[model samples]
Target chain A: MPDPILAARELTKSYGRGPDRFDALKGVSLDIQHGESVAIVGKSGSGKSTLMHLLALLDTPGTGTITVDGTEARSLSGRKLNGLRNEMFGFVFQQFFLNPAASVLENVVLPLKIAGVGARERRRRGMEVLEQLQLADKARNKASNLSGGQKQRVVIARALVNKPQVLFADEPTGNLDTATGRIVEDILFDLNQNHGITLIVVTHDHDLAERFQRRLYIRDGLLITTDEEHAA
Target chain B: MKPLEILKTAIANSFRSKLRTTLTVLAIFVGAFTLTITNGLGTGISNYIDSQLAAVGPGNAFTVTKTDASGGAASGPKKYDPSIKRVAAGGRPGSSQLALAQSDLDKIGAIPGITGVAPVIRISPDYIQWSGHDKYQLSVSALAGAQPQLASGTNLDDSSTQTQLLLPVGYIAPLGFADNNQAIGQDVTIGITDATGSMRTVAARVAGVEQDSLLSSSGIAVNKALSTALSQAQATGAPSTAVSAWTDATASFAPSSSAQVSDMKSKLSAAGYTAQTLDDRIGTVKTVINGIIGVLDAFAVIALLAAGFGIVNTLLMSVQERTREIGLMKAMGMGSGSVFALFSTEAAFIGLLGSVIGSAAAIGLGTAVSGALARGPLSDLAGLHILAFAPGPVSAVVLLVMVIAFIAGTLPAWRAARQNPIDSLRYE
Candidate 1:
């Protein structure tokens, strides 16, 4: 019954303009509570990712607003907004956006590095996170040399480096094998359960959606169904 | 990110595309190297010119002569007019034997702005010797405070009366001295024939040594007392044979400055005295050398300006290629100002690298070149450095390139800073 850590109301987003305009998110509203795991499920162009981006404050809504921890996110300056984003959110993408020239530890330490953490301590914390993820042996290996599963794990380590309040994953296991995908899924749930961090995942996988206690299903850019209600 | 952390990131990221960065830095290096060398060349030549000017004469004095007092052309080499001594109305090149009469001196001394007029009394000694070492007979001119370029030892004392002389470097070996330092304070004897055609000698201490120059050859210099003794010891004991209307008299002017020197010269000309300024002769030479140095500097500046373009090209490419990285950093809490600072810092680092390398190389190569020229082609112009590295200009060249690079990076950095985080992150 705690307040939603992240919530969006009547959020609308569109691509292009005039005749070419296409609404990616239309009046889609959702609430993600603190320490809760939620899944936003939709087909391609269904606005799941767009809604997630708005909730993460990476992009602004065209016609509506987003609020985080009771603050109107739309009213903050760019500097304050960026600082809030750094302090509150962590992200993992399907493609594994690791800098290939950097070492595994460096990739993990990037968010902390961008947060202005000192080098020695950032390295120490980065190594500790890597060790927790069983990636300590590969700390010095370049990101380019890592396997798909290892790369995803490295990306996840980077997402958790800042110890953000909420973790967002967009198709986190999309590029892994079935066995490796299961392990990655377990890790996401484990971090959610053990650390009590709010988890908002955008995905098309029914199996992944089935595991989350709350599921918002979007069709044609509008959230039209709740999985629990459907099951009832 | 903090400035220090941003700088660290900029430095690391600069090496991501090594070949491209190196080529850009090399282009900048060429520019900086040229700039450094040109500046040094100008410094070296100007230093020599300054030293030479100080040695030439007092700034406000000119050598005056009563040339063509009639103020008319000779039409040819006119025979001796008797009135103006050896020549007719106009003086010839070899008519230096003519002396200005006391009346003429009085007239020159009374000219407007003429503070004083001192005749250049010529003295010839049969031989100059030191410590039993004798040099051949030579002619010495007595010009107060006319200290020639010094190889060693102090300058001659123009007011001294005990008997002091400046020994030329060429006389060091002939005067039985190991070097100029040994000659200084040592007693030397000059052989002069008195008015009776009999040999008489005057003793003087060696005060300083003079370096010979292409403009003026090796000769002895004598203080006031020694010069008077030598002149009075002449074979006839009189000031001149032809009542020499002396062609060269040192004239002093009031408010001693170049502008006043010109004004004084024109006034002397109007008074029938041809005033020759040493600056009028040597100033043109310095101008020619400085003009050459200026042209060379222009070319170096052109090179640096061209290299500024290379910096722009390099930073623009970097910004384009790192679109995602820039976006990601923004998403991770880096403000737009930090993004701009990062790119600008990268540009400055490149500039620092190129210029430091260039300046160091220039100093090394310039010193070698200067050494070779000093002993070779530039030997006649003694004490000339073909290239000299002055610290101020060297540091300025480094700073100049850094500023150029910073300015060049602005366009690209601004573009990078203004990117929407979503758009950049979505960039493939």
Candidate 2:
């Protein structure tokens, strides 16, 4: 089989210190292969979001190892790490986090813009992804004016505009209605299966967890189960 | 991010809270307007002084007076000296002034590089009349040696034997001349009291009408022939000492640069003589005026400093309000450096907005005020604009405010840059 694209070992993360300290992630370990659709599910405070933040290189593990494509990313810091995260992964949060003042297209191209992509290429790529997400018509509309589903689509378009290897969606449909949430779920699965990009979703819904090829059930910062066990 | 992209975002972000940003920019406007106006005022007044200085004398020409001669303002009473002859100066202080006689002229003329010398003689005429009008006691001074500014007729020719005079506008009607133009070429007779106390009258053709200046307000400019004729008529009672006739001499040197002028002045000072550059005679008054202008400029700077604090306050609050937005950018792979640049650019944008609007408004209003003053309150003062603007200094004001904004934004931008994405995204 092909090498696992990402591997985490004994990941540990603690919030605060002293008596009031809380360990958000405790000695969790997992391996995800290329083009894998994986679900990390648990109840609130189950450390699923914390584990995803650590694995995505957005937060450092207190004590653990995370390697991406054979390079140890957990120890990396600053520009090199940020560059890796920007070029290798995309994130979608529940809040959407769009700059409401910016046009929808500007919001979508922000990642590529930060990547120093030229204006023409950024426009072509932004338009391409917006078309894929069926958001092409709303390109000129301000982000603030977009509906909840449309705003999430723009966020997804922004994430995919950079064409990273991994898409990390943390409660992507948490704020959407059931119809919009199902649509968003269908989009994430399509991106993983059709585009051959790895999808990592963090959700509390067991139904959504059943759709993933592999599942990691984390509880109180511990990984309780995974479909595969691999040191690599 | 490219600088242009960063700038665009900064600009867009600045107007997110339009009312708050406008209020901050308005604070900077007050500062920039006050600063630009004061700068214009200084420029205008200095330009006027420079034009007026050019009329006083040539670069190489300076008045040579006795060491004891007092001018402008002097402290304490002048001491009595047996050897220093007291000759009355035309517009100088003290009566017991040592006169510059023919011997002193020889001494000055003998100095190496002393190209030319002309004695400025003060002649007080008893009365001046023209075409049988009532004789009026008129003010008179001889300025045939230096460059003469004429309003209507030509300047006096030194070699011409015919006596020619320049009359001030105030004297045109009183001296029986129809107007400034009609007074030209009109002959006027000046009655001078001779050394023997007898009234002697001399006739001179009016060559020009002098433009009234603050220094030459109500005077008649006497030509060389008229000056010589009057001096000799009153020469008998004066002392027969070797250097006791003329009160002052204007010495001309070959080198006209200020550097060489100072060199010649030092040499003359060592010789126990006083030398006053046309600048020196008028420089003290210029300093006092500029000092007043400097005080005005300081107040304007204070206003700008206060505006700087307003910028700091506005930007700090922006950082607080944009906490989540900043975190999102950080999460999108923007380095801390890019984050810092974004906020700094935003502050600079606000500063640019305020200064540009303020400077533009200042130029608009300042020019109008200057024009109104010229035609109204300052009509008597010729060629004086109360305010002036230059492109370099005006642009500098914009650049200065931007720099201040950049400095003020650093603290807030630093806080934004150092923010942890996890914590900031978690911000409510």
Candidate 3:
């Protein structure tokens, strides 16, 4: 009944030029509602990551448009776009891009720091998020010293630290074992269901897609199917 | 991000490559050290000269000489003029100068700003002896208003009727005195040959002992009382016409400003006379010293520029190594300007560290060297320090090095700021 939180109209993106040009996204259209758990499923080179990048406003589309909260992405100034990303969106990647030399709390507090929060408040909020992820005891430990599963949880805490409206995860468990992958998946579903935060997961794993409320299967730079499933 | 946060991050990032950063800092240190030392040397010598000028007490007086109608000393020989009187010149041995007559002295005294004029009476003392000690050849001259640094006792009392003279420190020992204090208050006999070629001696009390100076090295200063007594004795039986002519005259003026002095000198120049202030007399020496210091400073600047290149190299490598980190920060919404500021701050921090260390070290070493020299080879020249560091110049050097570092950092900072987040993030 409410307007979709994000709407992309016939989005297309390409890399390089001339004969070497490859279309990473071609005429892909989608809408994501607030508090929805959606999965973008595709094999390697299927443009699922490119589509997620476009919707998250990290990359510009070659054609068509992306709208967040009813405002076109291209119409926003660079400062406004960056501010939107900083305050309203969060990202997690399979690689867990942490500054290894820094303490876990430092990595978790980065977004708040980018937002120019005071030191005392940044620490308090960072510790609060780490506590939520059951990582409070390890706040001072260096990011490099953590186990893969623990590192993923730290990344999740970082994504949640800013209280973002949308969380974008690109292959969140690709680097983890099955047990750890399942744990990460459970955390994502919990954030979507309990906290009512919109979740967009880009993955090729079928089991991962099955856990979402809806799945958009992409192939050869186009979305081939949209499947909706009822809650278990 | 906030400027404070950016600065903190930059400081932390600069030390990430410790060896590279330290080598760059060392290069900067070399430049800063050389720069501070040379500048200190300039300050030291100039300050000493300034104090010496103060001690000399030539604030309002200058030397005036009759200008030759044909040519001057620097020019080639000219046809002789019968009316011009030539006499032995002071300071330059084996050379003669055109004499200034009573008319010339009266003309100089009439200049509006000119307060007083006194002829430099030629009193050629053949020798001087203290009590019964051996006679030593002496050069005695009237100092007019000049004041020399005294090792002991007071300067000559020019207004006192008693003839007085200051004995040079070199003569203190040979003249049979135990020390400078013992030499003062003792009367010395000065023997002069009058116009009749007969030796006539005049006794003058030693009012003080003169310290050795860069100027007035071998001269004993005599007060007006002693000078007039010697002049009157030397002119005995001489023609009245010959007694009225002088080689040169010391002209005094009310110098409200340097501009006024220059104006007075121009007036003297227009009147067919050359006037030289004490500063003008010693100007050549100051020029030569300053030229040497300038050359040394140029070398230091070149070293700093070479060190600036080292900064460029170090920062470029750092930008390359931190590509991924830069991308992450950009993706988190740190603006391009902030990115540039981060790198620039790092460069400035390195400069601050190196320059502060170098200047502090130079000050330490210079103080010690100056102390040693003062007590050793330079002991004769009292009140002269070879190196001095003033707060203003020291701070200027530090600030200059920092500006160089900031300029050197711009290229690398620009490169880092221009990087595309997507491309940098995707870089493997």
Best by DockQ: 2
What TM-score between 0 and 1 does chain B of candidate 1 receive? Answer: 0.72
Model 2 C-alpha lDDT per residue in residues A145-200, reported as the tens digit of each score: 98999999999999899999999999888999999989999999999999999999
Which tens-of-lDDT digit does each residue in B354-384 have in candidate 1? 9999999999999999999999998978878
Which residue segments of model 2 deviate by more than 4 Å? Answer: A1-5, A74-77, A226-232, B47-55, B58-61, B65-166, B184-208, B221-273, B369-385, B390-393
After superposition, the stretches of candidate 1 with alpha carbons farther than 4 Å from their true spots are: A1-3, A226-232, B57-149, B152-162, B170-202, B214-288
Candidate 3 regions exceeding 4 Å error are: A1-4, A194-196, A226-232, B41-135, B140-166, B184-208, B222-273, B369-387
**Chain A TM-scores in order:** 0.96, 0.95, 0.96
Q: Order the candidates by DockQ, highest first — what do you get?
A: 2, 3, 1
Q: What is the lDDT of residue B219 in candidate 3?
A: 72
Error of 3 at A95 (Å): 2.1
Which of candidates 2 and 3 is the stronger one according to lDDT? 3
Q: What is the TM-score of chain A in candidate 2?
A: 0.95
**lDDT by residue for model 3 (A25-81), tens:** 889998999999999998889999989888988888999998898898999988888
Q: For residues B1-428, could you state the per-residue lDDT of candidate 2 as single tens digits?
A: 88898998899889889999999999999988988898888888887776666544555677898786454565656667675566665565654567877777888887766888888766778898997899999767644454445678887776889988877777888877777889888888888886678888889899987766655446676767878887776664655562246778888777667777787888888776888877787788789879988899789888988988998899899999989888888888889999999999999999999999999999999999999999999989877888999898789888988898888888889999999988889899
Interface RMSD of each: 1.1, 0.9, 1.1
